[model samples]
Target: MFGNVFKGRKVLVTGHTGFKGSWLSLWLTALGAEVIGYSAYFPSTPCNFKVCGLDKHVTHVEGDIGNLNMLTNVFKKYKPEIVFHLAAQPIVRESYRNPKLTFDTNIGGTVNILECIRSTTSVKAAVIITSDKCYRNMEWVWGYKENDILGGDDPYSASKGCAEIICNSYIKSFFSDRKNLPRIATARAGNVIGGGDWAVDRIVPDSVRAFSEGKQVVIRNPNATRPWQHVLEPLSGYLWLAAHLLNSPRLHGEAFNFGPDHKVDKSVAELLTDFSAYWSGKAKCKLVNKRDNRKESMLLKLSCDKALNLLDWSATLPFEDTIRFTAEWYTSYYRGKKGMFDYSMAQIKDYTNKALETNNAWARGVFND
Candidate 1:
């Protein structure tokens, strides 16, 4: 999808060693873009980028996003034409343990990115990735729109919510009238499940951890339902939105949510069941009876109509395919699929081709005007 859009473009990716970051880095390389990576070390054991050998493909710079001087130096050096900000403390349960770090990384790091952009004056487009948890957890059944109130209960979620505010505030206070500055937009995606995510405290990772260790995973809230989609679903939306904003700033400098449609909705148990069906593992899960108040919303949904109308973006992957592909990835990797690095690169190649075909068809019809 990005092969044509990013050819010869100088793109800087924050969180280049992260799960989504690794995938995006590979995609940009496939598209023939000169990629510069800026972020701290990989955030977890069995690091996603190292496992996938992504460092060899990117200009890896190990640094903190909170350091203004370092980030500004990178901006000045790379002179990036587009930026994707995905660095953050992304886990809710982990947030409960490290609230301060979460806030500092998510919110403060965002400020640093925008500040660097303001000072460097070379960037042309930027996409700040937040989360669906940015929405105030009302525990309602309705889907959140771009204009809905932004807030959160947990540190991770609240930090993302604060990041959203930062995006808007910076846009209004600094970049709104600076036509030469990069156009900025924020993207909110939900619980993204895929391979190479070995982080503790997340459902998919927890499940993998258990199954790989011959132990059953623990179920905290089997009934809690949030918009679940494959990682590529939102990444596609982000890439498309970035490309659109690169061309037309006025129509794209707002917030957008990207996730599977209503047909993809499933309970936690349902997702696990799908995974188990693929692997046929001897894993089990029991509901926690105690009042385990983790601050996760029981129900969170988002409407992508605004994105569809404005950026001509949509979620093209189905839930079953997501689950099957995810399970198959782990299965193949465990069975020694010529290293996890090639496996991840192969998945990226396949998914990017599929998304390119799908989006090109959609663009022909949607952007024909």
Candidate 2:
């Protein structure tokens, strides 16, 4: 997997307690990397980190990314060879409630990580995880490309856009020299959904909560469309991109979009209907027409052509399989299954098998560069 690049490597994952971060951390460990996780705090109570007992598998550090001193200390102590920066204020609705915190963490925290990478000689490659919302959304029919304008109206989206700008500036100002050791790149992924995600305001988590309690799931912006893919899709791109960066410097400071094919783009209501099919209980949604002060994009999409062309990476799961894999995981967890760590690992294995069946470049350990 990934040309055995991560095997026996020292990998550091920031925000390992969050949804996407936890999954990435576990995958790194499975790849035989010595994984270290740094995070300010767990974003949610029943987070995947705790649910899967990730602490037992990796070195866990608790600190705010905004605190440069603490974050720098972790970098010095760990001396990680590869870094995946996933720490950020990831919620859109919460950003409306606390814009300052969002800016501080998303922008300031990203700066701190770049500074650490700049100073750390042990680090050789990094993948900075941003959002598809980082694009200045025109709500148009077409998907956003890598060179699209960076701007956002909402605080969360704006902060992510600002993070991308900061990363670009750092790359140009500091890491521009060909002699620079740490080759850093940015990844923008579509809305990700999978198991063990219990964050507030996300459609999957909200649906899981409502279904577990036998209540009607509240539908907010049901007609809105998004490029939805399983969590493993983007994670594969990040891993493959990082592996290639270790040997290919031309990709440094570049940005890539990892999203599903255009055929997978679906409305929120459609996602709910497909997700409910695999649910064990009677799953239903109540569409509320109440006015929402917080603004969300009506349509969003990403073009993964860059990733496919440059890294030979593309999303493997279709719409139905994505929903089935997500719904099954949550249902099994809610049914009080033991050893969730093993269960999660099983899902990873299943995803890998699918990738191998399709002969995905990453699964075949084929590096395009």
Candidate 3:
């Protein structure tokens, strides 16, 4: 389904060793993109990038996104045509522990990437990846629109919100309306669950941690609801946005939310139940009794109509299938299944192709039926 979107293109993906970054790197490589990755070392010991053999495939540079000199050097050397900035302190709980690092990495790193892009001449399209939490989460019932006021409750969320502001500032101060300048867009997506992600404090990885050890997975907020989708779902949207931005400058200077259909909206306990079923494990969690009742948005969803209408993309797999595929991958990997890498690659290819086929089929059916 990637087809020739990335043929012979130099794509720079930050945070390539992280969970989403590892998946994006593999997808870009498969699509024939000459990929250069710049980010800090693997956040954890057993990183997804190492496990998936991604380092061998891409030209990975071990450096900090906060280091502008290193970033500038990489930009001058690689001369990337497209850029995907995903570097950040992604953990919410850890953000509480280390707010300063979160701001430096998330907010400062975003500004650093923009400055690097501004200095470079060859880059054409830039996609800054933010989080759904970037929206001024008001603890309301309605889904977040792109125009919603930006705010954050916790350090991680606030940093992401600040990153969005940085993106907007860069676009306004320099990139916007500048001829021959790169088209820049910011993307916000929901809680993503997928295979090969081993990040701490994340729901899927936490579930994997407990399930693999034959213990009950601890859920921090059992009733908290989030807009959950497979990792590939949002990656598909990001790729679509990147491709669209390459040809459509009208799409620049805008923020788009990529997420699943509303029917797939789920609570933490419901997700754990599905996880237990898919992986054959007992799932249980206690309601947290922490005193720092720094309010967390119980229900945060995004309206992805812009992405659907403009980019011609939608989440193909339902929430059940998303969880099932994720659990299956981890199960197969832990069980020493033959062709684990091959199997995971096959899953990506199969799911991506199927989504494209479904979307095209729906479009064709609109007139034929």
- After superposition on all C-alphas, the RMSD of every candidate to the true structure, in Å, is 2.1, 1.1, 3.0
User: 262, model 3: CA deviation in Å?
Assistant: 0.9
Backbone collisions counted per model: 0, 0, 0
Model 1 residue pairs with clashes: none
What is the C-alpha lDDT profile of model 2 across 1-369, one tens digit per residue?
899999999999999999999999989989999999999898887889999999999999999999999988998998999999999999998999999999999999999999999988999999999999999999889989999899999999999999999999999999997556899999998589999899999999998888888888888888888999999999999999999889789799999999999999998888988898777557878876654645798889888888888888888998988998898889889889989899989999999999998889999998897
**lDDT scores for all predictions?**
0.80, 0.91, 0.83
Off by over 4 Å in 1: 289-291, 353-369
TM-score of each candidate structure, all chains considered together:
0.94, 0.98, 0.93
Please write out the lDDT profile of model 3 over residues 42-69, one tens digit for every residue: 9775677887788678998999998999
Show where candidate 2 strays beyond 4 Å. Answer: 289-294
Weakest 10 consecutive residues, lDDT, candidate 3?
A: 360-369
Clashes of 2: 0
Candidate 1 C-alpha lDDT tens digits along 40-109 = 8877877778877877877999899888889888988889999999988888888998899899999999
- What is the TM-score (0 to 1) of candidate 1? 0.94
Clashing pairs in 2: none
lDDT for model 1, please: 0.80
